[model samples]
Each structure stands twice: as C-alpha cells, then as structure tokens.
Target: MWSEETPSLNNQQYQLLQELGRGRFGTVFRCLHRASNRLHAAKLIHKRHLTDSTDRRCLQVEPKAMTFLSPHPNILQIIDTFEDADTTTLVLELCQRRTLFDRLSDDGALPEPHAASLAKQLLEALAHCHALGLAHRDIKPDNLLFDDANNLKLSDFGSAEWFGEGVTMSGVVGTPYYVAPEVIMGREYDEKVDVWSSGVIVYTMLSGIPPFYGESVSEIFEAVLRANLRFPTTIFRTVSAPAKDLLRKMICRDPSRRISAQQALSKFIFY
Candidate 1:
C-alpha cells in the first residue's frame, strides 16, 4: 500500500532525458541522477489514475514486489522511489538493449537453441518470483527486456500479486494471448499461470505467431479458454520434438498439470 504523505525526494533530483515508453498509469524515461550522475529509468505514475482500486493496487504492488525480489540477475532492479503531489517516480536500472518483442519483430522467429537459452533465463527469473510468493500475472514478450549482453530480464510487475504457499489468486489479469485458461475462466489460480504464459512465449518464439489466434480480444479469450493446443505443421515443421513436447506440457489447460518454472528450467534444453 502506498502512503499519501509527500515523499522527502521529488522529480527535481533527476534530469529527465529520453522518453522510454508509456504504460496505463505512467511513462518511463531514461533519466540522470543529478547527485551521482548515473543513468536510470524513471517510471513516473500520474496520481489521478489511482482513483481505480485496481490501479491503486498496482501502484502499491509494483515497487514492493520489485524491492522484494530484485538483485537477481534476471529481474529488474529498483534503485529509488520519489513521490510528489501529482506523480510517483520510481527510479530503476536502465535496460537499453530493447525488448524481446523488438527482437522477434526484427528477426521474425529465433532459432530453437537461442530461444531455449532466453526461455531458460526467463523461467529462472519466474522461479525466483514464485518461490517468493509473487505471481507476475503479465509475462508477455513486451515485458521481457534485455541488457547490453542481451541477458533476459523480466520487467513490469504492476499486475503482479502476492499470495500464500497454498492459496490461489483471483482476477482476470494479463495479456489475452499469454493469459492462462484458468484466468480467463475466472477461477482461482496459483503461480502456475506464469508457466502457461511462458509456454505461449515459447510457441511464439518457435514459430513467428502464438498458438491461439483471433480477430479481437474477446475472440482471443475464447480461443485461450478452449485451449486447443495445436501446432500447425506449416510453422512448426522445423521445431524439434522435445521443444514441442515441452510446449505441450507447459501450455496444458490444466493448471495442475502445467509445469512449474523450476521444472521448466530443467526441461528447457534443446540440443
């Protein structure tokens, strides 16, 4: 939960540089720390959007989640936070190598080995989050970023939720294409939702498209709920058998059967 009291630090401390990206409640900027002269990414959230409970919860959860789970190689590090009357600024580690979506857009589909390597990194990060009782409801390509060496780092924890070991979470959160079936069905779900999303990512990486397709958001939800789980020979012709087997298990409709992030790490190799 965020406090309404004005923070000691404000936006003036950082020199805003380039506009990095924009989200529902905030815009990220590559900024400079005036005192230390270090580069950082600043996510400035407008206070007005906090009117909605969901928005407010997201505002409260993101920083806390980042602070709790960071310093890991694959999770984005939150450097500092500043708040004012109009906005809340979160200073973060600047990741400039672009995102997985950019890489997929430019290169179409990645080779199996390359995709497996990135998938391993992402799964390792998810394992860390799940072990700490945090579920990153959104696990799409856009949230998967790369650093200078192209190491994968998971970002955007706004839709994330914290739960007890056996307890399940409720809510229809996450991108349609990557959302798990239980989520779309409005059933209580555990962190296994992440593995389903990761499975979709692997499918998209192997072929240049997702397993389920629809003309609209509703239609996509329909397809996701159906959980057809198919592989069109035209696209998946070159994908290895083991890789496809892993996708089948990961993307399985039943959350109980869905492979956990830690299990996926051991099963992810594609030689």
Candidate 2:
C-alpha cells in the first residue's frame, strides 16, 4: 500500500499515482517528480523486513548491481534511490506493457518466432549480468517486463547475487516451476540456474504450460530433481528437431550437463 506521502531523498517532491504492485516486503507505486514530471516506480520496503541481516544485505546489493547494469536496453533502469521514514524506495523506469505472465495469460502459448525473439533479449540481459558477476536467482516469466518499445525488460533484483570473490552462497531461492535442479537440491549454482529457468519459460511460451507440474510442492520438487519434463510433440511437431534438442539440453537433470546460457542463445533452430 504505497501512498504519495512517502518521503524522498533531499526532500524531493513526488506526486503518487496508482499502486504498481505489492510483494512480501513492500509495495511499489508509480510516482512522478513534481519538478520534472519524470515518471518512476517507487518501491517501498518496510523497515521490519530490512531488520533481518540477509534482507538488509540484499537491499544493499541492489544499487550496486543496478548501477553496474545501468543503460542496458533489456534491464530495468534504476533512476534514483531515496528513503522515507523506514522505507527505502527505488525510483525505477515505469513500465506499462504488463508482464510476460500477463501476455501469456491473454495469448496462451506464443509462436516460436516470438518466443525466440524474447529469449534473445533475455539472454543478452543475462549475459550482461554474468559479465558483471551477477546472477538473477529469479527469472520466471512474471519478472519479465516490457518497455515503451514493447521489448523485454527483466526486473526484480531482490534475490540476485554476485558470485564474485568470497561472496558466493550455496543457499537456494527461486520459483519451483522455473528453478534449476541444482538450485532445488541446495548445491552450488551460478548463472546456470537462470539458463534452466529460461528454458522453462521458453517451454511455457511455446506450449502454454509448464513441463512439470504436480499435486503438491513435494511432488514438484521431485519432478525438478528428476527433471521430469515432457512436451507433447504434436503441438510442437512443426517446431524443428534442433529446437527440441536444445530444450533437452536446457532442462537436463544435472546442472553440469545443462546448456550454458551463451550456447543456448545460438543453439536453437531459430538462431
């Protein structure tokens, strides 16, 4: 529940608009600067959630990674950072094209060409992040955004981490449906996790459904561990065999055997 009254850095003025979204820690609202009429999304993080050391640490990491990612076409542009009371608001580019999830809901599975285009943009973003030693632990469809060009913009850095010197953690975090097997098993993972999730998203985009779903969380975990992915060929029969082979590599049960994001980008039939 974000409001216009939320404070800003150096006492900057803001005119609040509609709430953009709400999450476990805070709500994000669309806001505008009074002086410039610059549109932005203000993310309000409650003080309580920041009390935890992990949360605080992750909060600190956002600015660093985002600043490093500045000016990327497919990355969400963080414009300003400010604080009001106990809340920390990040002024970000206001995107209105809705999420990939919204698009999928409205259009069901996308055709192969569209999916491939989106995947190329996403891979470019991920490769950029990897170059910065950053890993976006969460890469599900819901986090994908669209800018003015209706192009893909991967947002949300709350779970992102750097695998840099003396900083990598073995902890696991991500949506079950899109997570990689290594991440679910609590093993050391790096950029590969994102590649696997992208694979799931690609599959979903083509088939309009997740490859593995189950009755409970436990079952889903098992399915992920075994990489129990099955796609009815009839629907994708027109899709190339090379594309299917790439999917097989992306969803491999073992992370070591899974396709690398760089290779996945060019290996698909469309590429």
Candidate 3:
C-alpha cells in the first residue's frame, strides 16, 4: 500500500479543471491548487484496471521513479500522489506547450539545429537516468513534453526499469517503431535500448517519418528487425554530416555498438 507521505494533498485540496489528455493507463486533467491557485496536471488512473500484478507494479513504480528523478530539469516533476478506493491520482508539473509529437505534427520535420538542441537535452536526461541505473524503455516524441519556455521534459515511466550492476531486463515492451532489435529478438538488454529509441526520434524529427514503418504492427516489427536505415537524399541533402554520423551510431543493429547517452553528448556536434 502507498503511504500518506507520497501525497501532500487529497481531492478536496484541488479543483479539477479541463482535460489535458488520455493514455492507456489514465486521463490527465489540468488542475488548480485551491489555496495557491497554481496550475498542475493531475493523472487519474483507475485502480480496477490494474488488476494484473505487472500492471499494479508499474503503478507503484511510477511514483517512486518520479521521486528518484525529481531534481533533474529535463524530467517531469511529480508534485504529489493521491488515491481513493476507485482511482489513483498523481499531481504533476504541467507542461502547457504540449508534447514534441504535437510540434512535429503541427510543424512537420524540425530543422536540424532545432532537432539537435532538443536531442541534446533528451540525451542529458537519459544520461542522468542511466547513471542512476534506470532505463526509460519508452522514449517516443509523445512522451516528451515541452514547458512554456519550450524546454523538453521526459514524461511517463510505466515501462521504465531499475537495475543493478550486471542486471539486464528481458521483455518485449515499448512502442513498436521505437523498440530496439535486441528487445524484439527476446534478448536481455540494458539502458542502451533507450539510445535506439532516441535514434528513431531523431530520425523522425529530421525526416518527418520513422526509420521503420509498415501497414501493420507485425510488419513494423519485421521492418525494425531487418530493415536498413536510410537517410533519403531529399531529407539528408541539407542535414549535417555530424548529425548523420550520430544517428548511424545510435540506431545500430547491435546494441553493443549503440552509442551510450554520455557518448552521444560528448562526441556529437549537434549544431
């Protein structure tokens, strides 16, 4: 059971405002703190939906994980957590500018410089998480939020894993297009999986399309497993050589050869 220390306020302490968005696990709403009148996003997850042990465990892990990365600027901050008999509510810092996915959808592919700037911030955040023995298995643009200042923040930890030395995770989890080949092959993998997803995100940011795509989920997975990564001349013609080099290192088929977050930050010339 979660303790009272996790949540400083209950339902009565805040007024729920407009709906922010919805995901497989829950719905997020823009909220107002009654006393302070400050804005926050509240994620309401139904307890009944988490009937399986794995699903329930993720619910428990999310708050703790958020607590672990709270001080990092590029990771979303959890303000508080609350629960009723029916649902669990998490109070979070609201990113009013929406997600990176929204930006891509509305503005098309980003210019290489802008993409590089966002990618650098993302790698910094991932580096912080990996240093602490955490792997954010999901790293799609949809999970990346932007604050009013347009600074990117990594959000959602439902698929995240915490490991110790020599420990590797084995599971087929994460979005299909972003999942690494090692994960699809059912091999034990570590934090490097995030690097692959980040690579896919960078590819999409520059090309307005994912490196692997298909008409169905199975086809997409097949493409991810066997497809060769290509930088179409139309898109790559204007992109920098250093940027392409970084992308190749990130999306390597062999996880062992995939660039670590720290390496990506130190070796690449994003500008």
Candidate 4:
C-alpha cells in the first residue's frame, strides 16, 4: 500500500540505462537501482506535458491503480513513486520478455494452445482488477507484458476507472481495433469493455488479423459499430469450437451480454 509517508528517492538512486518506450505523457526507461543493483523500469512523466486536467488525472490514476492491483502474478508491480518539481517517476518491475505486441510482430499469430495460455493469464489479471472495482479501459496487446520466465502480466492502467456494481462509465477511449462496440457508440460501459478488447486479442492471435479494419478512423469506428462477428474458413477453419464460443460471448455487441472476466476464465477454451 502507498501513503503520504512513502519515502521519496532521488534521481541519483537510479542509474538510467536505456529508453524502454514512449507513452502519451512520457518515456519509460530501463534503470538500475544504484544501491540494490536491480533492474527496474521507470516511467518519467514531465510536469510540463500535463497541459490539461485530464492528462494530470491520468498521471494520478496510474499509480493509484497500480497500488490497488499489485502483488497479483499477472499485473505489473510498482516498486515506488517519486515526484520532483519537473517530473513524476514510477519505479516498476522490469519485464524482460517485452510486450505481447512485440511477440505478435515477430511471430505473427500464436498457436491455439499458446494463445489460450496467454489469454487465460490476461483474464486472471482482469478478474483481479474488476473484483476491486477497477476497470482497465485500455486492454491492447501492447499493455500485456511478459517477464523473463515468460510469465505474462498486464501493465499500463492510465485509462483505468473505478466503478461499483451497477455503475457505468462513458467515454470513447481505447484503440480502434480493440474498442468495444458499446464504447465506440459512446454508451455507458463497464468492465465488460475489457472483455470485449480481450476477445479481439483472441481473434487476432488465432487469425493473425484484427476482426475489424478500415482505411480511416471513421470507417474503423463504423466497422466496430456494425461489423458482424465471423471466423472465416481461411483463418478459423482449424480453431476449436470451444474457443470460438468463448470469443463470441466476449465480443458480443451488447455489453450486457458480454462475458465477465471470471466467467471467461471458466470457459473450456482455456482447458
């Protein structure tokens, strides 16, 4: 748990190594703790870039979400947070195996069993977050990371929200390819949106292509809103029936009908 009393560390404590990646608000770096000699990822969010309340709020939400979701095997763990006048730095556990997006880029689609294992792990992480009244609004491949042991973990909760039972959130947030239909339509959605995004991930892993695609953002939004779910013979001919069934339940157009993360974990697709 984090508190006002958490000790703040100085920049000298970490030896900056290499750039890890860039995000909406800042850049992440691979750093070495000077005293512990441990590798960690540090997210450096510049205060100057926080031009609006929304940007600042996202910065605030990530650390809080991490504090709530940590200690889970499938969620990224934040070691510490330090704020200076110019930047807010998050010290995080370094995932040596990189992100699922990188894996997909290098390996194309995964075999059914491999995809199933990754999806199951992702569901476990989502289940943990949802159980705590938190919804990870962004559930794309890029946010799914793996440690040196090839254990998958979910990261990046900047867009996450806290909602109780019977609560809903309204906003058009998320990558176009993975956004739920209800979210694209600007309807009040809940944690089910994460399920929908995960479904799209499953489809991509099996077929090596996104379920919906278009040349323009507007066209993609339209496709998300009205696209029929189909597993073409060319792609899904070899996919198991149970997997397809699970995907359908997750990616349903009606958010109310979408499978919950816990229910999804119980599906035979993971068995």
TM-score computed on alpha carbons, candidate 4: 0.93
Q: Which stretches of candidate 1 lie over 4 Å from their true place?
A: 1-12, 269-271
Off by over 4 Å in 3: 1-10
Query: Model 2: per-residue lDDT, tens digit, 1-271?
Result: 3445643444457766677777777878888888997888877777677668778877887867787898899999998887766777787888974799999999998888888889889988888888788899999999999987888998988788878754555787889888888877777876778888988898888888888778888888888887767768777876667667878888887777887777877775456
Worst 10 residues of 2 by lDDT: 1-10
Listed per candidate, the RMSD to the true structure in angstroms reads: 4.0, 2.5, 4.2, 4.9
On TM-score, the stronger of 1 and 3 is 3
TM-score of 1: 0.93
**Worst ten in a row by lDDT for model 3:** 1-10
Question: What does candidate 3's lDDT look like per residue over 1-271, in tens digits?
Answer: 3322223335788888777677777677888888899999999887877879889988998899999988888999999898988789999999965589888898889888888989999999999999999999989999999888888899999889998799999898999999999999999999999999999999999989999999999999999999599999987899888888999999999888888999999855535
- Tell me the tens digit of each residue's lDDT in model 1 across 1-271: 2333322346577888777777777678888889999998888898986788888888988999999998999999999997877888899988975689888888888988888898899999999999999999999999998877778899999999988967889999999899999998899999999999999999999998888879999999999989998888998888899899999889999888888999888885445
